[model samples]
Target: MARRGKKKGRPVSGWVVLDKPVGMGSTEAVAKVKWLFNAEKAGHAGTLDPLASGMLPIALGEATKTVPYVQDGAKIYRFTVAWGEERSTDDLEGQATKNSDKRPARAEVEALLPAYTGVIMQTPPQFSAIKIAGERAYDLARGGAVVDIPAREVEIGRLEIVEHSPERTLFEIECGKGTYVRSLARDMGRDLGCFGHVADLRRMEVDPFTADDFVTIAELETARFGEAGRGKPSSDGQAPQEEIRLPDRFEDIDALLVDTVVALDCLPQVSVSDDTASRIRLGNSVVIRGRDAPVEAEEACATARGRLVAIGAIEQGMFKPKRVFGG
Candidate 1:
């Protein structure tokens, strides 16, 4: 008699929405999630500063193929502004550079909010990762070199007050990607006739990934490594989770993360006929007859076969490989 091996599980694929906790860098969190799944490919949709907390979308396996679609989405955040002070880093973590003897009036700050809204020019801080002359601007700044950062255009879709104290003010923000919340706080302080710096910060949304759909870091630990509620543990001893759903409360740290399976929305998808599916299993793009690509597609997605815009299908007996979706 011969012994038989157990059946292997379906290949794991999808997205992970981590409610990134404060005090950790985005890169570090992605590393832990990657190691847990041991997936061959993974990537994050947005970049969050280590000093901030909020929603982060981590794509796994085939989901990595769809990263571009997600990365280009709009973003939102909530943060604090300390009145009568300014910092070098634009946030509470930076060294104090200036202060005011008196707090700016609340009405004055409210009036300034209108000017900050809509499209406006902004300068990236020198103590940032922006590259210049083949070196990081932050590196140059750290090396005691002064560099001029020019102002460019950015849109502040919405800026509103959340709360205000004699010493600190909080705000909720919605803006396009690449907009810096810290810079906004700093600018607001200046526009309001007082010194100001970000005292705290947290992301609320990343286009498709909303804070409502986020799960705190501590919650991920429970779902991935705990008991029956741990979903499905990976073969590598890391627990796997089922589909993640949006939480009722934006502040829940232990809510379940959205599903880990990657899905392609807003793109043309064609189900291959029985015979054609088998022919392309050898790993090639398939070409078919009588198929009409979607009319309302993106400008890039409208290219003819082999332009990198088209995927799937094979010509003749061979599959044409254009863009490989899986990492």
Candidate 2:
């Protein structure tokens, strides 16, 4: 297949909370949405496996600048673990390497949840995106190389059983960044002595964005090109029916894009003066002094005239722009 050239698009900045469908890679989904919106620059906050689905927050234009903050936020995922078989990839996509007839009872699973909660050590699956010597771990594993991934501490706020069957167990987990649901399932299975793998997974929320904010691709298409369908026949039953025409303009697409400030909602907001905002934009630091100014050393979102100006730190009354948002 011949490679297609990139499309020339306007500078459209904002976040799109896409209810991504399963069986699509994160990169491919980002590309599709970028093309649909004709955005000049676009990126996604986190990677959802081709088998996983749900809230994939895509950052377009200036919104991409805040992707790191969003990615660092907590995430919620509901996944299923299929017992009796452990796969090489820790998910159904890979070959089974071990099996067992043992199945942990509901009570037994409940007792084990506490051990996995809080900060626990988790070894990422060999077939993961983690880098090993500058190469993807999955790529190395697929090439039949023995990959040894060390266990790292990950914070899990919550891990509970939503449902449990003889063949599979459903769980919902609220965890911090760098946590992998597949690895959780694998470790849980090992502890229960059933040897399992992730059968299904869906991210329900990612910090600031929840399932309620997600929009399907079809909905986006309709928003871009309004309700364009053949009108029904009149009472008199005329010839056929005229098609409903709707405005298809760039501004129409903009309506669907969320404000970039939504990504920084979790942080404290500091309203700055025009002069301070301009100085920050010019890569200069300004002193923030006022009753509402953030106290102590911490990160804050600086806004001027109701628009996000910069994300920076406040230390000793000085606000240093760590990442500035540009139009």
Best by lDDT: 2
Please report the TM-score between candidate 1 and the true structure. 0.73
Tens-digit per-residue lDDT, 53-137, candidate 2: 8989999998999898899999999999998899998998999999999988999889999999999999999999999999999
- lDDT (CA) for every model shown? 0.65, 0.85
Residues 132-218, candidate 1, lDDT per residue (tens digit)?
Answer: 888988899888888788787888889988888868888888887668777787887777668788888988877776656766555
Top candidate on TM-score is: 2
TM-score of 2: 0.88
142: Cα error in model 2, Å? 1.1
List ranges where model 2 is wrong by over 4 Å. Answer: 1-7, 228-248
| Clashing pairs in model 2, backbone N/Cα/C closer than 3 A | none
Residue 279 lDDT (model 2): 93
